[model samples]
Target: MTATKVAFTDVKWTMLVTLHMRAMDSRQAEPVLGDRFAAEAERRIDYDFGSWRMRVTEGDRHLVTLRAKRLDTWAAEFLAAHPDAVVAHLGCGLDSRWLRLAPPPTVSWFDVDLPEVVALRRELYGDAEGYRMIASSVTDPGWVEHLPTGRPLLVIAEGLLMYLTAPHVAGLLSRLTTRAPAGQVLFDAIAPWVVPTSAMLSPLLGAFRMRWALSDVREVERWGLRHRDTETLLGHHERVPSTLVRSVYGVFARVPPVRDALRAFRFDF
Candidate 1:
């Protein structure tokens, strides 16, 4: 069988990095987010991922999987409460979240991303009864129109917000929050310090730059949505590369600034 060619460039190419992270975890004996689909996708793709092998450290994969697990938990919880929910995964990339979650037919799921990315996804996994793919920039307000309304909506924006500017982020939130009757927006964000810290990863990041940062959750509240909760990946009692680093993290995790360096937030409209 011929492998699918992936020629995504610029920000679109970063999707492979996240996909690779999940694929790496899936290969683990005991994975955090056991996503076999991601592993298979990695094997099926023709692109050479050797360049990212060293770039994506253990800590990076750990944090990313943990963050995704948290969101997956929240999404399942939301679906339990509102079985007829509308979930729009912005900047969907090649992540097999829809397949992993496996929501019931009552729930409407949409995987949204760029045209090239969506095209590749369609080739990988075709459309289903309640699942659809939208090829458009998440930054574009018009894309929101494609989503069905009058049901509880859950917007999942993993590894997406940081790439957009403050205004773009605000506009996106406004569009999602205003349209949906009531629902939550789940996303991970880095603190202001982490924005500059991304510079250390210049080679891995390519041409993309981290634009937005969240100092506090309250800042999002000012945008009209009420803050639901905030969780930091650092505070989680999980295995790290070294016991000494875990010990130090346990100590510094108490510090608000250190804890908030990278966090996952949920806000209800």
Candidate 2:
């Protein structure tokens, strides 16, 4: 089979970074997400991943996988209760989340992203009986306005909000909450400090600088939803090679600011 060539650049190109991380983690004996589809997708894509392999550390890869794992856990819990629901994976990118969740036919699953990314997704994984692709920016409300609103909604915005502007995040959340009768939103936020830190250190992250930051996780409640839970992305994972390094991180994870550096938040409307 011929590999699919990707033309994504700038912010859009960053999706491949997360994809690469998940692909690498899926090879682990005890994977966090065990996203085999991501590994397969990485193999089918015709792009050089050498730079990312060199620039990103094993810990970084684990963190990426763990973040998705936590979101998956939350999403699965939500779906268990609401089997007949609408799940919109905003800024879906090339992540094989729909394949991972495998929601029932009664559940309407939509992978929402920019047209270019959606085009790539179409080639990688075509639409199914209950799954469809929406080619539009998550910040733009027009596309989301038409989503099925009769059932419970689950909006998964994994690594999306940070790239959007403050107003865009609020507007998107507002529009989403207003559409569904009741549902949940799963997303991760980086502290303001992470933005400048990434700019100074990592070229890959500097390419698409994170524009939005949430110092307080409770801020989302002000937008439209009630805060359900918050989890810090730091701490030692089984994949981290060094025990000493893991212990050091475990200690730092106790600090409020350090813990908030990157966090997963859940909210219900």
- Please report the candidate that would top TM-score against the real structure: 2
Tens digits of per-residue lDDT for model 2, 41-78: 99999988776533554447767887998899999999
The runs of at least 3 residues in candidate 1 whose Cα sits more than 4 Å from the true structure, single-residue gaps closed, are 52-59, 200-204, 239-256
Report the alpha-carbon TM-score of model 1 versus the true structure: 0.92
lDDT of each: 0.85, 0.84
Give one clash count per candidate, in the order shown: 0, 0
Tell how far residue 258 is off in model 2, in angstroms.
2.2
C-alpha TM-scores of all predictions: 0.92, 0.92
State which candidate has the highest lDDT: 1
Deviation (Å) of 60 in candidate 1: 1.0
RMSD values for the candidates in order, in angstroms, are: 2.2, 2.0
| Residue-level lDDT tens digits of model 1 in 1-269 | 67898867778877887888899888878677888999988888998877644364444677778788889998889989988999999998999999998999999999999989998898888899999999999987798898888899999999899988999999899998887889999999988987777767657555446879998778788888899888887877355444665677777688878877778999999
Count clashing residue pairs in model 1: 0
Can you list the residue pairs that collide in candidate 2?
none
Query: Could you tell me the C-alpha RMSD of candidate 1 in Å?
Result: 2.2
